[model samples]
Target chain A: MRMAELSRTSGVPVPTIKYYLREGLLPAGQVAPPNQASYDQSHVRRLTLIRALTDVGGMSIATARVVLSVIDAPDRTVRQKLGATIGSLGDIQATGDSGGADRDEEHAQAAKTVDDLLERRGWRVDETSPARAAAAEVLARFDRLGHHRVIAALDGYADAAELTASNDLDVLAGIEDEDELVETALVGTVLGDALLAALRRLAQEHVSGSRYRTPPR
Target chain B: MRMAELSRTSGVPVPTIKYYLREGLLPAGQVAPPNQASYDQSHVRRLTLIRALTDVGGMSIATARVVLSVIDAPDRTVRQKLGATIGSLGDIQATGDSGGADRDEEHAQAAKTVDDLLERRGWRVDETSPARAAAAEVLARFDRLGHHRVIAALDGYADAAELTASNDLDVLAGIEDEDELVETALVGTVLGDALLAALRRLAQEHVSGSRYRTPPR
Candidate 1:
């Protein structure tokens, strides 16, 4: 299909499709000539995915690109790939591996950064240094919070993400298929937003015991 | 205080602080004269909030700005104002009320967009068409998958977010402090992230015994 057809089918504007191509968020179509190209079902899939990540997941293009790299990277396990993807959430700087006595300089700096932010809030987190303690507390709180059901969903999500990532990796891996990779990234992102949004609404209903609460509750 | 002093106290670098000011993420300090500005405890507090929003909360500058607006907006109930703040996360598209319906177009568009994304992922959400049903399901799963202890924590978290949002709204209400409003937004974003990440981890740990598993015959 031509770009126009692709745009029509995907509900993305033609100019935006061009922009995705330029940003390396979409792969190039087969060159029919110097100025023209052809797209396929893969293009539709990829475009859909791109929209998902950007529109729904709210990931920056650069972050989206990094995630795409993991989906397309061969020689990496699902866990490793996901870790790399999660790494781009822009927090969680590397310390030496978890359970290591020594922390890396980058992680140490990030920890300090996080701590300072916490102390500024005047929230008490038990520790010798408020900043370090705050960062640790943030991690601890993740453990303390309830709604275990969400975690199970996350595990399922992780599993789904893994399966999708592997499936995508197999299709795009080692093929120099930037377009396919972008498509995979887009799908992952869009689905993630949909899933989370859906879950959030459900959770709100059950937890809050109201579909929409009246003001002043 | 000198930049170094501020850096040590805030645990943020002078360069980074400068970056924040330059980016308008933080309000500028009072200029004493040429080439000199004095920052006080307020600046320190502001910087701390800035860090929390950016790093811990993972909000974009634009989103952060919108949040701050709510915090500073005057003459509104805490509940009312916080609802507006939370709505920002949905990336609500601002379409002029074509005199059709207040939020109808926006919600419909959002739901349609959300629905399309979910359909691509093969999740069987009912066609009530708002995508709210689907979202609700996801959240329900979280509730089910979550550990017993986690529900207690989520209760606290929901309380915290609600409480913080309400009180923060009241404190800055009727003042039109865009900075404070943005600060409120930052708090919401960061706190939300912190709460969810914590919940996700706990849920992940207890997925086996929970009702989240496939029902056995």
Candidate 2:
């Protein structure tokens, strides 16, 4: 297949495909005798994944590159793909937004809160887990706003997270083919985030309707 | 009261606040005599929310503007605020990334899937809910990838979403003051998304560890 066919089949633009190729996000095609290069089924699949990550998952090009590397590497296993993709997805935020003079005190309190949450949940994760740090950062911000009550919402959030992860891993473990496993892991990591976010929005609306009886003002 | 004080209290840089002011994302502070403008507690709170939405939630300034407007509007009710914020938050992506001729067919199918999902879940939402469209768009992308398997994860994702939203609305309904209510709604809507995403990542790690007994590659 030519580049045009790759774009056509994948529903991605030709220039976008070229951009991914140049950025090394998509592997290069076989250079033919002429100027044209021939793309294969793998190229189409790769381009499809790239679009799903960027357009649906809202991951940046750089982050997508790292995710793809973990997914496509010869030695990449399901564990590496899951760890790296989840970590990279957690990286979709600007650092240092919680700057303040009491930063040290706030961080200390936040760390304790995270630790307490972990201890209560009895989840065995590493000290350096980005999700733990990310959760702590959110708690620190809630403290900053003089809205410590938001921290009370964490347990419910954690319960939902645990249940969802259990479901995800169950589906993952059932896959027999390594290639299918990698593809499922990648798609689930990327588009799966969007799916969850969308459902949450809908649920928010439903709950809000019942919580507040007032009409739209 | 001064710009420096506002920055100190909010932990947001003066220039960023000024940018927000210039961009109308932040309302102008009161202009006192001696060419001095004084910001109050409201400014600090609003500024903090803006930073959370932009930095932590990864929402663009433009989207944040629409959100803040809805939340801070003089005529906004709990109903209006929830509907508008959740709707705008769904606009966090660049629309129409799939640039092929089959976009209409893809969208038609996506819309049906969203409708079916809503009906199955017995969710009560409007015809024009952006969450529905966002979910549809994601399903369409999965279709484009020829990876229909991704849709299988939607039910589990919906379960997590419902639990999180119920928790969020419960916390939100507990606030007595309208100002406090609006603030919590804004912070929770933005930061809550990140918190859930982070928790999901952490849970993914825990599940993956137990699912695959093999070591990381």
Best-fitting candidate, scored by DockQ: 2
Q: What is the C-alpha RMSD of each candidate to the true structure, in Å?
A: 12.6, 3.1
In candidate 2, stretches whose alpha carbon ends up further than 4 angstroms from where it belongs are: A1-5, A96-100, A209-217, B96-101, B210-217
Error of 1 at B87 (Å): 3.0
lDDT of 1 by residue, A55-160 (tens): 4455567766776666767778654554355434323321111322222443454455445533443323323322243334343322222212222222222332
- Where does model 2 sit among the CAPRI classes? medium
Residue lDDT tens for model 2, B116-189? 88889877777788888888888887787766655766777778888988988778767898778877877887
Interface root-mean-square deviation (Å) of every model: 14.0, 2.9
A1-217 per-residue lDDT for model 2 (tens digits): 8988887777777888888888989989998978789999988777767877887787789888887887778876766766676676676465545455687788789888888987898766777788887888788778877776779777988999898888777667778887778777778766877878888888887766656653643
TM-score (chain A) of candidate 2? 0.87
Backbone collisions counted per model: 28, 0
